[model samples]
Target: MEGLVKKLNRRNFIRVSAIAGGGFVLGFNFLSSCSPEQRPGQLIDLNAFVKIDTNGEITIMNPNPEVGQGVKTALPILVAEELDVDWKDIRVEQAGLDTNKYTRQVAGGSGSVRESWESFRKVGATARQMLINAAAMGWAVSADTCHTENGMVVHKKSGKKAKYGELVERAATLDVPQEVNLKSNAAFKLIGKRIANVDNQAIVTGQFKYGIDTKREGMLYATIIRPPAFGQLLESLDDTAARKSPGVKQVLKFENKIAVLGQSTWEVLQGAKMVKAEWKDDGILESTTDYSKNLKSVLLNEPKEESRRKDGNVLEAFSSAAKVVELDFEAPFLAHNTMEPMNFFAHVKKDSAELYGPIQTPERTRTRIAELLGIPEEKIAIMMTRMGGGFGRRLMSDFVEEAATVSKLAGNIPVNVIWSRESDMSGGFYRPMYSYKYKAAVDNDNKLIAWHHHSVGVGSSAASGDSFPAGAVANFQVDTEEYKSPVSTAPWRAPTHNFIGFSEQSFIDEIAHKIGKDPVAFRLEMLEQAKNNPIGKVNYNPDRFATVIKKAAEVAEWGKKKAGNVFQGFAAHFSFETYVAEVAELEKQADGKLKLKKIYCVADCGTVVNLSGAETQLEGGIIDGIGHAMYAELTLTKGKPDQTNFNTYRMIRMREVPEVEVHFIQNNEKPTGLGEPGLPPAGPALANAVFAASGVRLKTQPFIKSGLFA
Candidate 1:
């Protein structure tokens, strides 16, 4: 029984947990599609979908959404492990926009595998159990005596065996295992090993489809024209020219917006540009520089709400401080810049509404659409497609609403509302621009004393003005002076952490340099302080924090350096229960530009499920941080984003790609997040290096320093 239980849990295979005499089973499809009718487009033909046919070919319905994050490969590897099938014999198919079998789509937050880890295993394990039980009942043997291996249950005592494929029909009728035993880390044959992305073949072959590649029969493509400035309404419009344009279906004008509904994407693009509409500028709105300057002014005068740490008298500590280092930092707004942009396909009829697009939170989006359309949530079907890149972009349902509204406008015809690169840029859900004022001090013996950091920034887009100030920082005292824009805001990967990464860590770097201590050593000292004696009441895990920092130092040769122009700075951060530490090496090029030669990041994110996928995230996240550190900035000159696309809104390119080395700390603990933790450390490490290289205390962000730009 123990052997079978261990086996059952190890692969998320079938269980006799709730079954009587003869047991039951379920596979990947069974779990992902517990109730087939509920899933939007469940597979009717089980042959091509996941099934154990006569020959025991373990077929799997490859969950849609080819997220570059490696879920397409990592998720199936989880299922294949649980199913106990020869991985070489597994068959995969793109689960069509089917909500029944593939609900809760739009993969982000590094959740595809971890969130569905046990559940997907249950699906595969249950199916295998059912197969084994059926074979046992047929052979008149006790199910306990028969154990499954490589898709066959062998009656070890009698040396009798039967293939799982020979009992598919009977297996499908068995009940699912409610309670499943998961495999120990030691028994894992596939997980934690390097598994290549499953969709690489389809993507390389041009067979993989993103939302931009989505095409439907008789589906009209459309483009929208929103007010250029928030609080600005279109006073007038001219549609005559657009109506005459080739393949243009209709020109739509509603309140402050316009849409060029057309037959193809090109026609919509051309028509929308031709159908010119003028808008009076809403001068009352705030521009980038205006907001920055005003926010800085307001934060100094205004007192903020408090919900975080505060212990021994900060005022008294500051008053008696022998030395104090105080500085302010600012960061511009950021665009998600997802290559596919925000687009959705919606077909709403009287009976039901069917939708397909790229979304990170399909469950949440479905509920939002149901409320807006006044349709029952059950009747609203959602399908997810491969995201070009989310970066926390698709979490917004505004695009989904836009599609539904357009579909209703097109006389309930299936409408695919697509936003161009400019639309994506101007549509305006941005990484909120922020400012930080920090003051840190040290006493006579160079012992760190009081540290005070005041944070200011735009609120969460998902929560709007309703969020951010509530619990954005620890010891967080945030003063939110609402800079309301018609331009919406939403979650950009790591939320306020992006700005805090710049503000807190960079300020810490300044403090590190003043105290004449290694930046890594300084943060570790804080972690030590935070652990041995915390300042106030906050939910911070200092042990993990110290572990990551110490581990990072070990891997990066944090203290030892032979000597070269390459100046190294190290930083570590803990967020979302994951710990990451980064060491960056930088030197001045002959051209006066900074050259990032290498970055070594050691992460303790608990158990690493897929080595290749986690490493990719580490690499991508590091580069993402580098891009924001070195070049990426969203400046506002005239109440509109200045850097609209990649041309001005530059991302780190291949040549600028730093040599990144990632090492994961192995442990028996369950996995935590690997997505956003590494991001917080890059800016501080790089900034510290800049100081070491130039002998200039680089205190403020837009790290190049305005004088350098000038």
Candidate 2:
């Protein structure tokens, strides 16, 4: 961490770039240190990080990624409230993922909103004060009498005002202001308003371009074919017939794979079909399920260590308990079926390279591609676009590396490598299949006295990057073993929140049933202990947690019974300092299956920014989470993924989507994460509702396939 400012504000304003021929046209930047030439009575482009364009437009840039959670809308609302800008004119853009701009670019762990509140407001206030200073200088009057409104400078005595647009170039010349006053939440206008997403217009229309849409001229499209089984290598490839395919240009054979490069996407596919290729697994191909079995034994019996916390003794309490309850939960691997498949377009011309695509981690992708290509990081230019849907799939850099390799093989020409829908599904970068084993014991009054929870899976950081180690419970232990897989894994929505919601919440339910206590009351009791009890350094805001639970219960009418087929199941979880509670309604249909009716979601993820965006995330999360619960799994046969595409891998569809109603508590606090916080609770909530209706406790995932309904 350097004390000194690295450089003056530069107008290298990052914005959406329309692909031009084979490369993007670079722009001129503005970075000046002189007093701005701003009009005497206009909004100032203060030395602060936030700035307003003269056209009454507002732009706020910071470190957070907008992976469909509406960071662009939520974050700017925090600054626009203080900067005195019209909501219509505000334009939120991605800040350079620089340490100078944002301390942490890693978009997981739910730290987005909690980490940036003070820093973002400072940026806005600094700009506002500069406008005031510039106004007083022009009016030859004391700055105290001047007031700012709608990006204009107002002088009461003289009845004089100036538009901010008139101050653009002048504000660009001013020194960065050192001090500025920020508005309190009491004076805010947009903080609690139900604004829609700022980027929605570009998204809904066909004009919204994703990384997969990035195009380059004189560029080739490529597709790679690898060994069908995991740990297999390319024995050999004969491309004699492939080179003759229409539009086919070249066929390349890497160590273990073959790539077909051509002038069009169609040509690449055509050539790939003619290439003769087979894999030699080197004798490492084994059943993915078999490896998972080995991993389970490793976690359960392999000398587990206590990586987290313990507030009380468990051995004595469990021994004396009048009752004990136990259950094991299992979840299979999940795929992030983003609408637009993974795609990246890269062009390397001798020394410098250009890349355009949908990138969640632009800086990381740049570094990785540069390293692989033996180029300086600065020599690479990266541009990003709105995603069809990311769900943590775009966080990895391998797709970018593949594009770079294809571009190099195709010579200096820019190449766009678009992964076909089949390619995206078959190529393995997925949410790891997971499982959890739990044990709990209760005292004479049915109060929970002792508990032990252990989770087993691949690539799950039950306690990796976050401040809270998995051991957040008393007399508790968590063990995770990364089950070996040929497929790589990245963070899926809510990450371990998926498994935690199941194991922790379900155990709570089982305990309630064993003790003859109401589920909600039982949860409240546990939360009372959770409030006073410390669970390591990781944050768990007790008050907010209670708020969502109470709010959800009140709205869902927990005590009321909807007779007939509809049954209600309630669940609540806290992650990323945000709390979400959901009540799922289920109906046992004539076909002997669970049918979802309606889901009520109440969330307190701190403050709400984009009402539509927040609700959309809630609605989408429930559907996706429920989809996994009802019908989605990746079964393995001899170390190979058996499910190939959407035909076999079903998702919750139009008929399956339940009527969803989401209510956000109006709070003055700054925003927390909205994207993933809503996903974890949906699963347990849905499962709970199903149990209420069927009298069956479904512990295994893809519950339908587990024979609960069958």
Candidate 3:
């Protein structure tokens, strides 16, 4: 029997069809816009699906990328919750990227669950209503009297019950409901509960396939030799030895790189090593010292551009202040260092291309490939794999484009390009190096009256002018300068907030100590002023920000006296529309060394979809942030990255990770972002804790460089 389909609006549609062996297949188009005239079979834009078998088996398709952020499990739970099905009865599958069907399919910005919360719920609730309506017709009762519970439709008065699978044919014949009532927060059975990640079993068993594991029939492995330095161009190439290498099939040159294709990864790498290439410096060869000096020069002597934000006169306030504090902070570039590295498989045919990989932005990648290959966008198919790690590296499609380019250039054959650890490290696109110069003024009463912030960075500005302490102070000004470097930079995790949070919060902590007030209390006071009486526009919600700060302080015993060796530090930040506060507990060892004891984190990301996933995100973000802030730094030596691999690139060791306790403010407020908000506060909290313990302040990232943490 053919299924019934209905158009809910210009952007959404629902269709129900009968499965071959007596079941129901429900498909929902939640993103793409289509006309009513589009037939159900003709509309291939359905992004989400729910299927039921005669045995009452259930299946759900998750449409977002899974980058260890738990959206793979959390999004499907939204559908399962409203479907009123047993969690064990449902099977989840990852959906490939379909540009015509899904919007916002990329996994960056921590927006998967937050953006799809309401629509995913409607998908399941609408399907449940259809099933209830089908059962009601069979029982000769009103649809309103039929209720669903645990995948069963029941008639309350008549006491007739039918499994959803049994009513598939009837449900398939009914019109799709325009709207369905969603379960209230208290009625949610699976959302807030702690459920294991859907891929846990696969991962633990080593059955999960990452992008690097992709293999296709007769596909050749490729390794590309790229420029050695940031401002270098390929000058010469000799590929005779590379082409004659064992298992090598082809050696091709594209732009400034040489591609070596072979039967295996090892063979391709060997072939690439045999190729002789010469590079010439095309621009200035800059070093880390150059970046620092240039930025400091701009911060000290350059004329400032129009202020990003300004309230009262900052100069006047500073001139009349009883005391003023000035401090300089610096952070170096950082690599994404994803576990899987960069790899993509592409089969570029005459009219179409098939691509498979773990790319964060599939639509954008497809568009770029289409433009490069001179093919229609629809001819390109991208299947996103479960990424071992993305952070923000996969957001760039350079690797995917390389695969497509190699495949097309090598006689239109299938090719899988994989980057070695060194290649991945030196391939550029790192987090920009940043420097902040802050000046604060206080009156005789120790009341902070003015705030002036000047920041300089490579590529882009890392300043959020309207963030916290903006409207709290009477006189505030923020301006930034960008240094045009020959290095590439992209968003890394929380982007600007990652380092800015540390600089701003550490400065706030310093100011609090200078004024003889508790760090937490001082932050709360500023938040109170921003909430009640503000100096300018306040971008963040002061109340929510204050709540997380108070919670973290209370949970960590912020101001409570500790052992003679233990010290605590507090920091709070607002980013990605979520508020987070963290307290770092440190122990001063007998040898004058310090060790991180534990971290207490409190967040207000609104409703938690999956308790386990939410907690895991918070923990992961904290660990990642702490690791980067404490040890990770990517520097340049004559336009070449000084650290190319794990040996040179210092990473926080496992033993160095401290215990983390995560708490969430449970509310029905719309979910914001959880993946990144937890990160921005961790670094500053740890820095503050170090200062409290040693009475020595850290003004630079990779605190080990100070020879204190070492």
Candidate 4:
């Protein structure tokens, strides 16, 4: 059995024995120095992420959630490379939620690599230094003469070598180094290599456990029957038939919804369907309808939050311009459509509770659970599982809260709340629908003069107002109009940039067309302005953005002809601290339809870690962007979503996937975000390509509805 074997108060260090396979656990709590403030019996410290056992096997704890973004594999690679351990000899374990120990345990904004890169490398370097010190002491040689390679310390003068396992006992006695040396990029062995995911075998063999697969002893299944439309209040409920259903355990009513519990998921689903309920409309339908029309009206008349960005005389620029281009773009709300739906398992007692699920922000989940159950924050334990897909969907913990509430009401019998496919799809909290009106002025020489834009949406939480061209253009102004809706919304994928990139890039392409300039060359000129001329404050690196744009164009043969009737569209954007450019190739089919033939993408996120993982993320992001831009749409009718499941809500099919080529700029700069940067350029590039082929510019998303794809 494992135990808390050691507690060294000198440095606030603690150890647990026999982890994974009889290895010692080490952790440091800097807060331990401030007593009285630091709670008793609780050691809130950054725990040791690397462990070594007697057999020379190692375990690396991954502190962030793995929502198919490949952080599960990429972060651990940093640890193994710095520790000088062979990739084959190490295993990765998903760390339990402990915000104090793993300070930035949450995963969002594509920051997993950027945030953990240095600290995790330091963790490995520190452990490696301790092992080398122990080996040098054992060999009676100078520590400087001892070098580490492949998890072993070698003494050059005496030709003595010791495995890390042999030095673990001695290493634990050494003081933690204040600063340890980290290897240069050239010395990395595992970081940049093409390494398979540590859990690939388990995944392929169907042994991987996701949040939906979480189970416990005496666990009950639950299904929530919520209102069909937003702002609807439950008027009455009839759970008599549900309670008599087969395998039905209990039916409970909440303030806004009803929950049906059973011994199995199928029974819970059946029971939920049987419990009839009526809801009163809370004026949601009267306030919102015909999303596009309402948004346009709001943009014209509603009071707006105007962004503070003025560089030149915008009124004079537009009045004296040789030409002006105006376009309006709209996109509908989008659902995440996570394959594993929303689910969580909660077992709450009087003073403590344990929640296990796939949560992107476990800290938020813990806090919400505590507030809902009236338990202390420390009493809640959150265990994260492998997620099927997050795409910014799991960032919110509403499902976890429901499970905790149901568990409390069910006498703390371990309850697992599962959202049905319909409920998951129809439920609110989606990517906010948005509309944009852009007006641009250009001189006779085809140089851009001024830019004005107004955006209307339900909320401006994520990426709504921060358009990229703000600093790139000399005179730019932005305004946003908001429409209050009971339908909840949150960030989806790249947040506001996802849709803004499509609209903004597409509009820029249109301006280029009106001026009889190549789209790629026009964008290049803009980047050069941000690079050389004086802009207010360019948030993106002009050199990096231009590099990716040039690289993507070079790779895709920007203006060159292909074998068939193919045309190319190019777009570039910076988001999440990373720069990416993409080009989509469209072929005119014989049936008057545009076939996506191929795509080329180039990214510069700095210091590549796990080349294979980064490429996978880029490919996934590009495809996701293409799917949402081409076919995905969620419309509201009478305050109710029109689509529920995949049948009504479409997605990009495998048959529609084009040949994708991904490239990354090589550099030693700190790695930035990868999971989201590739996505922002995909939609605009695709739409631009379609226009080049058909001369029909798409001013709205979901080309299917816009009649461009059709």
TM-score, each model?
0.87, 0.88, 0.95, 0.94
lDDT of 3 at 75: 85
Q: Candidate 3's residue-wise lDDT over 476-545, tens digit each? A: 9999878887898998999889999999999998998888988888988888888899887888888888
- C-alpha RMSD of each candidate structure in angstroms: 6.0, 6.9, 4.6, 5.2
> Which rank order by TM-score, best down to worst?
3, 4, 2, 1
Residue 450 in candidate 2, Cα distance off native in Å:
1.3
Give one digit per residue, the lDDT tens place, for model 4 in 91-150.
889998886556647778887787666656766777788888888888788788989989
Q: What is candidate 2's CA lDDT for residue 407?
A: 79
Estimate, for each residue in 570-593, the C-alpha lDDT of model 2 and write its tens digit: 888777557888988888877767
lDDT of 3 at 22: 70
Q: Any idea what lDDT model 4 has?
A: 0.82
Between candidates 2 and 3, the TM-score winner? 3
| Residue 480 displacement in candidate 2 (angstroms) | 2.9
User: How many pairs in model 4 have backbone atoms within 3 A of each other, for residues 3 or more apart or on separate chains, i.e. clashes?
Assistant: 0
- Clash tally for model 1: 22
Model 4: pairs clashing at backbone N, Cα or C within 3 Å: none
Candidate 2: residue 98 Cα off by (Å) = 6.2
**The 10-residue segment with the lowest total lDDT in model 1:** 461-470
